[model samples]
Target chain A: MTELKLDQALIKKVISATQNGLPICERPYQRIAEQLGIGEDELIELMQKMLSAGLIRRVGLVPNHYALGYRFNLMTVWDVADQSILALGEKVGQLDFVSHCYQRPRQEPDWHYNLFAMVHGRDEQEVEQQVAQIKQLLGDACRAMTQLNSLKILKKTGLRIRS
Target chain B: MKLSEQDRQLLNRVQQDFPLHPEPFKVLSDQLGVPEQEILDRLRSLEQQNAISRFGAVFNHHRAGASTLAALAIPEHEIEEVAAFVSSFAEVNHNYQREHEFNLWFVVNATDQKGVEKVLNQISATYEYPLLDLPMVKGYHIDLGFPLW
Candidate 1:
């Protein structure tokens, strides 16, 4: 596992500057480098290092799923056997329809679900069909599951670095 | 939003693995066989149309700071009030009202574990209901860039 020294002042400055999104220009990197008072090559090298270190996931367009016709976004929660979760979670995540899958801490008594899978679809029927497929895949290992459909988006913003 | 065939091609091509060259748009133009200006224009138009939320580096929240998915079961009558109160905090970036018992859900992110805890503690103290804090143990399918067409 490669550890990134995110605490470095240069790295923090770069993250803060480019986190909102890069400038749209013919020489975007150069423009950013100029703004940071660093040479373009040096800026690019630091960015490449960050990308390699897994600090920056990618440098690309982030499409709005809703605008792209994926209207229904459901966060499906599952309570699978603790012993089988790792294997089952991997299987669930491999499904083409499942966008995000994770094993999260489960709150006892009221919340027993440990596995969460995010499913996106164009409509209710499509989402239900996808959820059913997950249920079948889990089989008897899954005890209880529920789908939480997003009713409204209250707030959505990019990360703001507190200086 | 309706998109032309050319628009679809340009979007699908530029979604991920964008070139890091000096003239990145020119590189894309060479590969996609579209004029560099046209590609730029289309991207700008798409962004204006809300088709593209952002076009830049996407950071890994866990790598940069501490974050968690939290939920609170706010009563229907006070949903708006609670939602507004939660949204007031700078740490609460993505907040949503979901159809479940734990209706009010949001993601809290901060520079460190203590910062994250501070935000969570404040929210918990304000609300009479129990807050369910679910931090990720492990994430699969983190490579996001899904096909848009």
Candidate 2:
């Protein structure tokens, strides 16, 4: 976690405002700062600090893959040996086709998959082909894996830090 | 939506190395060899069209707070009812129906593990279904945003 010691109230306010996203204008920081009644320079500096602290991942446009013609998305989960899972997860995360990769806790008995990677492609066949490549990449290390395609997206929004 | 070459370039370009300046659109405009107003208009239009989900920081959830990927295996008749119930929580960021037997999947986020547990237990009891709580252990990706092209 990012070690934050600044005014917690200010940070919370900033978080709330950022939920609407930065203004799509030349002076977005200024607009947001004005609304929060803080100096623009201070706001920018604080944001920079947050970026360095890993509190904020990026300050940019996040495009929708579906709108961009990459129709198929799959949550590819693998049951990798816990001992070597860390090493394998890091390697798989670096793959260009794999986005949002992580090691997750396993639910025993019924579920054993832990490592997760989100694979998006132009089509289902493309996604399957990428999964095949990942299989080859994992080689003997991957014990088992499965691809779960979304039958429906009830809601697909990021975590909202409400005011 | 048919993306013009310029729109495609803008989408593919801004995923990484987005400027932090007060006038980031200016930097994008410079990169795309267009006026700042054009970049602003394009982004606004893209967002309105739902082509851009968000236009700011995509924070690391675990770093920001606690989160868990949870699932519930509900019968077909109860799918809609359960999905709606799960989606009602402000804590649930993502909820989806998957093809697996453990069909319903959702991510719950909170300030701490206790908060997460509170919601999980409540959901489990209210819906009368066992939730497979899979908290994230570690991140392997910097999430250098997915390539749009």
Candidate 3:
């Protein structure tokens, strides 16, 4: 990993710039540069660096899932066989319906599933059908639990470099 | 670094809820009294500058189907490998390396509880590590998007 020296001013500017994405314009970066009193090329370079360092995840749009009509949602957990975990994950991630996938540690005594994946569908049956396909792929090495409803939805914001 | 008055207007309009109708851009353009081409051009430019990651439909899995949120503690050395492995699942939506005891966390959405359990079981057998199924008992915050200030 490359060492990054994030200065207070740069961090502040980066956070502010991201918080206020470039106005829809022909040369949005140029406008942001002007607002920050910096050269366009320089600002661009800094953003690139920030991305490379994982300071910012990505500059992208987040669609409203509810508005899109995909109302049914749940998080699934899995315990996959070690030998075929990688191959299985690769095959699963390729599906367009699956939005997010990754692994996490299991807490002792209660946790069992390890491999985690997300799937969406038009309805419960649709999602169930998708999961059935996954089960066919993984055979007996999968266990799961689903959240019938979300009790709360906390703040969803990326990391901001505080000046 | 100059913005035409139209640019400011488009930004203000696009920042809010987008129309669901076909030719939503057209509607926005007419409402904002700007050309559709201009609206699209600015949006494209904004994307190029890393202003917006992507524009598309977002899904609510529970209403649509079944899903679960899970986490596991993976060895630091195997973090990348595990992530890559988990990401391969078609049902896996988003995975992240967080700063926590259960460092390796990922979201899995499936049609039903059985489907999710099957995947987890398979992963455990394959990885030879215990998987903690930390389903979101309570979702404190679910929105993953933030407005650009």
Candidate with top lDDT is 1
CAPRI-wise, candidate 2 is medium
Who is ahead in lDDT, 1 or 3?
1
In candidate 1, stretches whose alpha carbon ends up further than 4 angstroms from where it belongs are A1-7
Give residue A42's error in model 1 in angstroms.
1.4
DockQ of each: 0.73, 0.73, 0.06
Q: How would you encode candidate 3's per-residue C-alpha lDDT over B71-106 as one tens digit per residue?
A: 667787887777778877766766666654566656
As for TM-score, the candidate ahead, 1 or 3, is 1
- Superposed by TM-score, candidate 3 places the C-alpha of residue A48 at a distance from the truth, in angstroms, of 2.5
Q: TM-scores of the first chain across all predictions?
A: 0.90, 0.94, 0.75
**Alpha carbon lDDT of each predicted model:** 0.86, 0.83, 0.56
State the lDDT of candidate 2 residue by residue for B1-149, as single tens digits.
66778888888788766787777788778877988888878878888888887777667677777889999999999999999989998899899999988999999988778889988998988988767988878889856686655
True contacts kept of 3: 0.06
- Worst 10-residue lDDT window for candidate 2 chain A reads A1-10
Q: In angstroms, how far off is B58's CA in candidate 2? A: 1.5
Candidate 2: stretches off by over 4 Å: none
For model 1, how does the per-residue alpha-carbon lDDT over A18-82 read when each residue is reduced to its tens digit?
A: 87888778999998888889989888888888888888888888878789788888999999999
Q: Pick out the ten consecutive residues of candidate 3 chain B with the lowest summed lDDT.
A: B140-149
TM-score of the second chain, each candidate in turn, equals 0.94, 0.90, 0.77
